[model samples]
Target: MMPSATRTDARESGVIGLGFATLWRGIREQPRLFALAASGACLYTLTGVASSIVLGEATERIVLPAVRDGHADWPAVAVAAAVIVGVGALRALGMFVRRLAGGTVVFRVQGHYRHRVTRQYLRLPLSWHQRHSTGTLLSNANADVEAAWNPLMPLPFAVGALIMLVTALALLFATDPVLALIGLVVFPTFGWVNLWYGRRVWPLYAGVQRLRGEVSAVAHESFDGALVVKALGREEEETDRFRVHAEELRDAMIRAGRLRGLFDPLMESLPNLGILLVLIVGAVRIRSGAIDVGQLVRVAYLFTLLAFPLRAFGWVFGDLPRAVVGYQRVEAVLTAPSEEPQGTRNLTGPGPAALRLAAVSYAYPDASPDGTAALPGTAAPAGTASPDGASQDDAAGPSARSERPVLSEVSVEVAPGSIVAITGRTGAGKSTLAGMLARLVDPTDGAVLLDGVDLRDLAPGEVSRAVALVPQQAFLFDDTVRANITLGLDVSTEAVWAALRSAQADRFVAALPAGLDTHVGERGTSLSGGQRQRVCLARALVRAPRLLVLDDATASVDPRVEGAILAGLRENAGASTVVVVAQRRSTIALADEVVHLDAGRVIGCGRHVDLLASSPRYAALLTAYEQAARAAGTDAMPDPDLATEAVS
Candidate 1:
């Protein structure tokens, strides 16, 4: 379980510090852009004060004399109008620069961090990713990064507002001491009101931001599993689930809005109230001749000009906490530990890389020591069907899996150019072990080696060039078949044809409307399940990996087609070692050797026939598989987790 609101509050005290620290980091990294923005903001804000001063001068020199003489002073009025226009022109120029520079600052920082987050996502180990929701990660890279930088657009303007306030205060004092005192009283109250408002809105803002990620996560999950949701008649349930999150997000934003509803009124009134006070007091001072109407006008106008700046400050005060929360979230990914340190060691001469798993043990990070996991709401590993209520996928948000080790200390070996099959019941950890052979994951207790080089020690990209794992579930991008198979590789058309032939996909692909150019649609939705699986195979085969791990990659294909594919793999194994996670008896029989597992341990390792003859447990398992196969009438596409229906 995660921490509660009360606990998060302990960190809330540092929210302001976090926001400024991020601001400082951005300034240091992109100094020129921010400086330009600040210069522009100062120019405009100061010109605002200058405009007030010019108005006072115009009133005293032109208006008062004209009124006294009952005639307009045309030349003086023209000069004053020109001066005001010049100041206005300067303000416009400043506005242009500030807007241009401030926009760059916001986008550049957001782009920089978004790239960092994405690269971090690619570089982080699969295990690290499993701990987070895809939606949350998306939110971090997109929405959170955007939120963290939203205040930047207003930040420079706010800072200039500060300078403007100070300059205006000095001018007010220079103009009239009594009027200046009112500003002194009113501005501090503005800060105090903002401070109070910020404290109230901070948590609400954080909640709103967090809920955005929740909404994103739920939406992504629903969309990604649309088929399952619709097939199971779960559309209404999914909608309800989404509505729950959307409503929560709406409620949170409303809460923040309600706080601002009060805060904005108070902030606006302070400046206007100052203007009123100055007017009432100035009327008396005018009668006594202590201060003139022009001086009072400048003071009241200064108060009026200050209204927007006060609101700007209030905006920063209100927004900084949310920015802090978002930055904290984005930084979590940016600073996450990268893939385990690389090693300088390289693989020795490699043809078909020999595989070795020496007492390899793996426990899902939060699994019980004995290899049982008990997480309640884990997402199943992607290639599988429904979650089956498996807690192991919690390895994604991982504590979602149930208690039990996925793999215990299991040892296995595969010679070069050989076909080995990993067989087990549903939870027998077949896919987990195959993943180790290909270095998809590291073993907790032992090591996986390729051509006698510890996979971890081999230089990066070396293993990938030599190994490929095609899991039971096939995934395809929304692209042409050629693009999907080559995946941007510059492979010769001949080599691609040969791979397609091996996977039994060339004929179907050749008949498509545009042949290899036909768009597959997202996740290969345009193709049948078997065709998708075969296309995935062609993708891996085209690479000609030295070792290929198929975690039941042919499950959906016809048994006859699967047999031909197996024959092709056997021939291909002459140059590339093949590891198949299998449930089909025919698939197992074709293997040169089979490793049988129960629970998380390898219980048998030998030829399929030998295992059935020697180990009753293996015999019973296969017999049950055969019975399930007969029942399904699908040529022994056995359910790895089916109850043993055959009496031994």
Candidate 2:
């Protein structure tokens, strides 16, 4: 959601100057193209005015003479008709250039800003993402960008309308003083009516744009949680939730439409009145011998031609409110503070990177400045627990819900090539600690180091090359298995197979119809849960990272397959430092040493057997986990998040 202060400011900033200024900025950004479009618009306007003049000349010189003399002036009529056709051809050419160049300007500006927004998305910290929903971000990058540039399509037309209005006014005055007076009144009235319409419609348009995002958000929420909704029989509830946002959007659009309808006629009638008044006064002027039939026809025709040109301003202003809101929304993303600055230095090592956490204390970026907890998705990470033994998509929750560092000041070290288990009940900050190992997030206070060098000091891509963090939720792109594993890396087929073997995913992959070439579909939906987890593991393994942080990465895999992967990793122990967020007793037993965390502090560290005998909380949590597994009548590990919630 946008901040109330920002939205209020937008509502207060009326559409007149702001809309014009916004349109000017876009034109300025793509000057060359807008110049072409403007040039075309000017040509179109000039030719249109010329056509009216030519027609009036035909009436005065050829038609009137033929009627008066009772003879046909075929030669002169041919000449007049040729001139009109020539003017129209030029007008058509101008319209073509205006449309083509104007379209180019819009797409280029939109594409430029869309790239900027998405790049900013990647550069921002996870904490920032938490504050915004996926739907809102999508709206910002896609819908908002397009909306921000919507006015550009009509901008050149508006620019040319100004020229047309000025030229028409001058030509009318030159034609007859009485007719010029009508132009003066009609044009300003058109502007005034549009101005009135803009002021009243801005807030409504802004409301419609804002609710567009909300509707998208609700629809995304329903779609993303479809399985849960269906299982819980909450389809009607989700539909109602979506309908509320949809109805708000519908109401806002209707209000805007109604407002436009009420004012359109007034704007439309001003030009009609100009023509009507011209005809009325024009007859009087002709009878008085002050103006001839040619001049009267010219003045009235100019007014008729200018009806649309005057309303061109109306077109631009009509789109202005939505454009302003969208531009402001996009600006918010572009100007948002970025993540921790990267360093120029790179880590150099062939062996595993040693690990260190020096009094690490991490508070989410969106947490209160005073260190007070925020809502579930902001101050705390987002994840949930399933009633089943395993989490369907669980990561961590707002367990402790503290604005203070989830992982309080405490220090630990891990030797290179050693496997260490970071165990805690739920929200004891185990996942937070695991994230530190991979620098997915930086600490609020203190530091995490690798090989005696602070992680922050390493240049961008250095940390990624040296470390790989595999979360419980396995993400796979829609591509071949080989493509997912290599991920554009120039790894050979042999190496891919090697990583697959190590991850214990070789057998199933080889059994596929196309082997490594088999398409995984989106998020690997074609594969079973365990197969996806193993493939993700293979992806990490292929990198040959020096540090591997598995944050409950094996939750979906069976115990046998998990053991095989752990065993294979053990065989290659000296190549990478392994940090596992452990829950199962078997996993804890294999670690070189166990780091038992309780309430964000390391309560015990040593062999798992030693911790069981010493730390009561550790023993109770594991005891609860094992008993729950037994009660479920399966070897599946109970969700650590659920266990921790119970213990805490």
Candidate 3:
């Protein structure tokens, strides 16, 4: 378990730091975009204010002359035409820059978010990933990042609008203070309404996003299990469940739409009401000769232009709550506390130190829905700490000390170059033990030591170089056979084929049409279960790590394929520690010694013949494996003595 004090501090600091760092990267990387947007906003506001002033002056100069003295000025008319053309040209440039800059910023921010999320995923622990759905992570990386840019898109236009409105109001105040003050009164009310609506919409949008994730998950699961769903004839049931989530999402959208429908019309009316009041008072002033007719015309036009932006300002604020909520949701994932805090550590090379587990234990996380208790350190079935070092209480939180004994007071040492096979029943913590060896999870009580140094003391890269675990469910990317085989190593084409040959995967791969270039499809769905496992096995072998961990890696392959792969591995064996979690009597027969586990405890350890004679649990486990293999259509059972003698 991670230390409570350290993990808490790091989690808090990391989330804030990562968020700000990403924000800084956006600004630094897009300086030109920022400049374009700022320049565009400046030009837009300047054009609006200049147009209003020029129009007002032109009207007073020409219309008043014609009305009072029966004379028209051609020069004033020409000047007004020039102002109109200049303002139109500036507004066009403003629109071009705003669109271009907004797009550039959104793209850059999305790229940054995708890269950071990928890095975070690689660094987070296996247990952390186990608890989260892949769909939610995908949504955070793709959808949430895109939505976060909503507020940013309207910023330049909003700023330009505000500047134009302020200038227009100042000009109006110069002519008539009473009308200007009345026009501004509606703004406070608009701000209050915006605040109220923004608060109400945030939670709804968050709920919608959550429902969207669920819908995606359901769709993904349905597609992945289409065969099972069809075979079970539950298509209608599945469809109904999907519809429930979809309808929930639709209803949320409708509610949000209704809110906007009410707000938008109200927003439109606010400015129009202000316009009516401004025009009425201005006409009175004009009649009293307190303001000129030209000035009154200018104020009215400017107020109308202000209407577009004021309404835009409301929208910008309206979208802000949703955008902020999206940002926070993404931040929660990107900034989550890691199971292991990463540092700058590099795995150097193959070292001669052996692996030693000294009094280690572990427990399942409290948040797991399955209530699967961990190894040594969890409360015993009797609800008390066992003398062997199992915990007496339940594990607490993310940073809690493990209470279940996933492994307790258990100490083992693997001599360099030896093969140690762990034999156990289905729930005997064999996989958990293998995980500990690979540093996938830290122990609760003692520590796993490499050579004389604690495993944690070695750099992570070094630890990775030392150990590798090929899990039961072997996974591959949607790529070619060569890519999957060479995934773990920085190797040439020759090296890749060599590893494949050693893992006995070279024959089938060579038979494919594209050979090394054959695309594997998603998770190697194009390949059989056994072929996928071989490819994963080849991946581990390619790296040539000092310690090779096989957690039932051969369980999926045919007995013939398994035998051939094991033969190849044994021929090349040297000083590497090979730990196999076995369910096959044939697989166990290859071990230098077999360790038997029962209820998370190692009850017996010895050579196969010795265990068969001395340990009933080991005999029972072997009998079960043989029975399972027979049921699966394999006619042969492994001869314990013959198989043991062959590998040894």
Clashes of each: 19, 3, 16
Candidate 2 lDDT, 387-496, residue by residue in tens: 11122332333433443456788698899999999887665777777767777678778989988888888888888899998877788999999999999999999999
TM-scores for every candidate against the unseen true structure: 0.91, 0.92, 0.85
RMSD to native, candidate 1:
3.9
Model 2 ranges off by over 4 Å:
1-14, 365-400, 640-648
Query: For candidate 2, what is the lDDT?
Result: 0.81
Residue-level lDDT for 527 in candidate 1: 100
Instruction: Spell out the clash pairs found in candidate 2.
Output: 372-403, 373-403, 426-644
Candidate 1 stretches with Cα past 4 Å from truth are 1-14, 338-341, 367-403, 641-643, 646-648
Best by TM-score: 2
Q: Which candidate is the best by lDDT?
A: 2
Ordered list by TM-score, greatest first: 2, 1, 3
lDDT of 3 by residue, 368-486 (tens): 33322221011112121221121122112333324455566667777877788887654567777887788777776788877656767676576787777888778899989988887
Determine which window of 10 residues in candidate 1 has minimal summed lDDT: 371-380
Residues 503-535, model 1: lDDT tens digits: 999999999999989999989999999999999
> How far out, in Å, is residue 239 in model 2?
0.8
